[model samples]
Target: MNIILGASGQVGSNIVKELISHNLPVRAVIRSRNPGFDSQVEIRTADLFNPEQLTDALEGGNTVFLLTPEDPASNDIIGETQQIINNYKQAIHANGIKRVVGLSCIGAHVEANTGNVLMSRMLEQGFADLDIEKIFIRPSYYFSNWLGFLETVEQYGVLPTFFPEDLEVDMNSPIDVATFIAKVIAHKSRSSDVFELVGPQKYSSRQVAETFSKLLDKHVELQPVPKEKWNETLASAGFTASTTANLVDMTQAVIDDIVVPENPDAVCLPTTLYQYLKEKLEK
Candidate 1:
C-alpha cells in the first residue's frame, strides 16, 4: 500500500521501523538492493535518475515518501527535479499515488534562484502539479548532522564550521521528524499539513560545543574554520568544494533564520539535544 523511498537513510529507517511494528504493509525502494530492513516489508532497488525503475517502483502504491538531496552538478535544482517529473509522469497517470509527503526545507520553494536551494526547490516542483494529497514536512537542521563531526572530534578535539560561536540555529533530532512522519502514515486524517519539525528550543554553536563536552567527557572546542580552511577540511573528508559551499549556504541560512520553518501544529517532543547526544555517545 505505501511505497517509501530512501528507506535505508535515517528518516526512512525510522519510518520502516514504525511501519513494520504497526503491521502495515510497506514497499520500500532504495538506491541499493540490500538495505538491511525488516522482512515484513518488500524491499526493491531503483536508480532515481532512471525513469523506468522509478515508474516501475511506483506501481500499485497509493502513497510515496520522497527524499531527494542536493546534487553538486549544474547547480540547477529545478532542472534536476524536472527529471523526476518527466520520469514519474507516466506512473502518476497510471498508478495514481494519492498522497506524497515530500521531505523538503523551509526555503525550499523560495530559493529557486539561489544555487544551493536548487534541490529542494526542484523537489517542490516535482510534486506541485501532481493530482494528489501533498504534505511538505520541512524540518530544521538535523541534530544528527553533528555525527559527521564526531569522527573529526575523535581525531582532534575540534569541531569546525562556518557559523559563529554564539550564533543560534533551530535544531531537531531526526527522531522528531521520523516520528512525525510515522504519525502522518498512521493517521489517514493528517494530510496536506506542512509541519515544521523543530526542537523545542533554540541552541547556539557554543551550547552545542558544551553539549559535546558533556557527552564526550572531553574538552571539545568549537573552532570557527575559515572558508579556505573549510575547503581543505571537507576535501580531506572526501567532499567537493561545491558540497562545501552548499553547506556553508545552509549554515549561514540557519544563522540568518532564512531556513527556519514556522510551527504549524506545535507538536511537542520529550527528548532534548542532551538526550540525543547522550545516547549517541553511549553507543
Candidate 2:
C-alpha cells in the first residue's frame, strides 16, 4: 500500500489526486479530516509528531511518501527536523515500511551551514541505515512561492522578493512534482536513488513578473526587497527570527549559485512557468 504523509498540503494533495487518477488506492495521513478528497481515498487523521499515532499511520504501508510540515511556531529548524528524524526512524522500523519517497530540495547535498538544506541532508542520512528502498526527490525552488507575493502585486502592482531580479533560477510547479511522485510510486522496479526535478525552463524574478503581467494583462514590476531590511520585514510579516535568518542565508546561497543541481543529468519535468500561470489563472 502507498501512504502519503502531509496529504493535506498543496504538493501532497496534488499527489493524492494524481494517484487516484491512476485508479490506485492511497491512505492519506493528515492532521485533520478534509472534505476535498475523493470518496475512494482512505483518510487517517493523525499527527505525525506523535509517535504512537505515526506508528499507527505507518502500519501496513509499504511505500510511504514523506513530507514534513514547516511549523512557524518553532524557531529551531534543525531541532525540529531532528525530531522528525527520530519519529520517522521509529515509525518506519516499527511498521516495517519497505519503500520511502521523501520530499527534499536541490541544495540538500550540503550537510551543514546551509540553512534548511541541513534538515534534508539529515533526513536522507536517517533512512540510509534502513534496509528498504528509498528515493529522495530534490526539487528546485517551487514556483508557487510566488503566491506569497500576490497580495503585494494586487496592492502595489509589484512582485517583491529577496532574489535578484535578473538571476535566473530553476523553478518547478507542485503539480509537476506530484506527477513525478505518482509515476515513481507506480513504477515496478525502481531502485533506491535520488532524483532532481525541475521545470522545463529557468526563470528570474523579472521573468516571473513578466509572465504574471502577461497572464494578468497588467503591468507588474519586479522589486527586490533589500537584504539589510530582511529581518525587520520578515518579522513584521510574522516569521520567527530563526526562520528569517535561515531564509536570508538560503537566499544568499542562491545568489552565490550554491543551490544548483548536484545531478545535472536528472530528468526535467515538462511544466513551464507560463503554462502554470495560465492554468492557475483559469482556475
Best by TM-score: 2
- lDDT by residue (46-93, candidate 2, tens digit) is 777788899999889989999656765567976877887799889999
lDDT of 2: 0.85
Q: Compute the lDDT of residue 189 as modeled in candidate 2.
A: 59
Off by over 4 Å in 1: 71-81, 112-116, 263-266
Q: What is the C-alpha RMSD of each candidate to the true structure, in Å?
A: 2.5, 1.3
Q: Which lDDT values do the candidates have, in the order given? A: 0.73, 0.85
Mind giving the per-residue lDDT tens digits that candidate 1 earns over 62-129? 87888775554434444556676566566656777788877876666465233355566667676667
Lowest summed lDDT window (length 10), candidate 2: 110-119
